[model samples]
Target: MHAIPVSQSLPETLDPNIFSSPSSPKVGSEPQGHITEQVQTIWNPYKNRYRVLASCILSFANGMNDSAPGALIASLERDYNIAYGTVSIIFVCNALGFIAAAFFISTLSTRIGRAKSLMISEALLMIGYTAIVTTPPFGVVAASFFVTGVGMAMNLAICQVFCANLANNTALVGAYQGAYGIGGIFGPLIATALVSRGSKWSRFYIIELCLAALNFGIAPRTFWKYEQESKSLLPQPASEQQDRERGTVKRNDRTKRQWQSFKTLMSNKPTVLGALFIFAYQGSEVAISGWIISFLVQFRHGDPSKVGFVTSGFWAGITLGRFTLSFLAHRIGERTFVFFVTVGALILELLIWFVPSIPGDSVAVAFSGLLLGPVYPCAVHVFQRLIPRKMQISSLSLIGSVGSSGGAVAPFMTGMLAQHVGTFVLHPICIGLFVCMGISWFLLPKAERRDE
Candidate 1:
């Protein structure tokens, strides 16, 4: 394929097909008005810059919304008069939302297009946040959690896919995920400050609501009319659209496509291993923060009021690790570095579990987060190269959803066990999960290309 140079100034009327990819433009296509402006708007190099900005916004919001609960769980327990076991059920609801979104989001993306589907997801976030901002009834609050989880799942799936496509290489993708770490660090602090001041915990959600609303306005415009729109805008022969539809049947068509995509994704060796690896990785990672404060307060006898901030330090390490370690992963190679980081994390997990001092455990937790930080972006980077391009988005979506469900399930089970045995189980369970992660990584199909 040869490149077509976009003009600095196209004529008043030019072929609508001029916006097509490097492939030759179709002849006899209708000439459209304002072709120059459209070219600058859609195909300009600066458009990707704008998309990167959108990706950061979504990443920050993702961290803020998901991580805040780590800081707010105590407040939720107190305000709702719930037990640890009961509060853990909320994690199940959230996981349910992520699992449910995984099954249908690819089809949704196919039907409405990714950009519009992303906008709808953002809108769902707004509604969920608004629902939670009030000191509502317990049932209402729980339902709100489910709604917000659905929004987060869809946003994450779309965000990962969009950025993977837009990023030129692994380093760029790492930078994008680094922004997520920064957001995750800030997320808990926002909630902690409000709680520390004796303000209503519900007020914490107000900030999330505002951010969601801002992204709701910006993301659609940033991602408007991606791949599908390109097909629609280019002038296909009049017979082409008809010929394409003639062979397709309407009956059960959408369901078949979703199931087929799911099956294909699950059947791929690299995809299955990648998904399982994340399922273990996020499971272990989230379990640490979700249970760390409780572990400290209940078992380590750390001040109940102060231990929650320890989660901030944990996420801060994650932020710094992604920001700093990503560059190093780029230099040392992602696959090799990931193995070292995971093993290092295993050593740190043991320190947290066996050392048993509040200060020692806290430091170990932060260090573990640092070691674990680069894995997510690095995994996404590998998937981009390893998965067949045709199946990338669907496979990645499944991986993301299953992985996020792991995040929910790990913490939920920890809470259930904590209910019986006590929070002392936190670090040991985390250690075991990380060990499982090590085995999964060993089984993963190696990428054909090495990191640049």
Candidate 2:
């Protein structure tokens, strides 16, 4: 099979310096002087596998950070002597971090290269973890989450871009995200167990601190060579094309070129649709996960201890769908499969909304998670296929970070609305979001290329 050309989808007027560092490298930049000049040699099997493993770790860390926030709320409020309303600021701060990262990470990735960007992110994460473990003032702890949020956004975007650019099969993407699902399953269990069993709640971050340290070690080794492997960085493989791009844009004007590309991508049909699609999808997913327990207890009069275990079932279903269905969707058709999955999830959500049976609602909740799980990775697969390689890192990051804010925003919105009405509204809100998801999917332009 022939490799898909990275520059094929890139605009002809694209700047050569978009992914290239200046000739005068910064003091800490990875040495790129020995980059090879062979076109075919860019594909290194061993290095490809190494990058995939690094992406898996990145995803796991994403899950580790995201899954614990809900579990920590009571602990954070009680231990820190903060009000419940004040503790909610943690989510607000984290969401702000994601939105802020979207605007800057593109420039950061372009200026330093993806490898160095991730290293900085890891360092930031370590700092955030260390601060959080101290159980400092509530405000300080909330601020620490914003620091961690920036780190996760950078890593998440960079890794998604790196893996997507590798142009490997969608199954690899499935497995990468599937690792996050596994981590999500484990994170809540461990966090809740330790807190409930007399362990200090803040101690959970010590485990994450250790994980961040491990990521710090793994990231540089796997990604430092990205400048050498990623095709768009230099024109060495196509010396003639290099000469042409050089003639069109000057070195000092590269930032202008980057912004131009960003504007074009922002206006593109697929990119816009992709963002809204993920916004609704993430909202649907997080709302259910965050509110299921309250919905079960408040509306259906279920036992808190008994119904809490149902969240495990929900997460388990998600993990299974991500690992299994994401791969299966690739074989069938990502777009078609996703449309049907949303429909199935819609059906289950209605069951939870209308039926008063706790056991029935519990089963519906798990099935809803099962169906919702594959949507994220599958949408990613679609985004990589539709968005040009040149814009994907920025666009995917925009989608990832902006879309992730939905996880926080949607649940928070549900909680506020539920206060006036009731927990029963969770299912209806999710259903409305899923319907928006369907519309977004319908509006998305068909992929010019689909992985077969």
Summed backbone clashes in each candidate are: 0, 0
Q: Name the regions of candidate 2 deviating beyond 4 angstroms.
A: 1-45, 77-86, 231-256, 300-306, 388-390, 448-452
Instruction: Give lDDT tens digits, candidate 2, residues 313-408.
Output: 677788899878877887899899999999999999988888989989878877877888898878876776777644654566556655777766
Clash pairs, candidate 1, are none
Among the numbered candidates, top TM-score falls to: 1
lDDT by residue (256-308, candidate 1, tens digit) is 65466556666888878877888888888778877788878777888755777
Candidate 2 clashing pairs, residues 3+ apart or interchain: none
Error of 1 at 264 (Å): 3.2
TM-scores, all models, native as reference: 0.83, 0.82
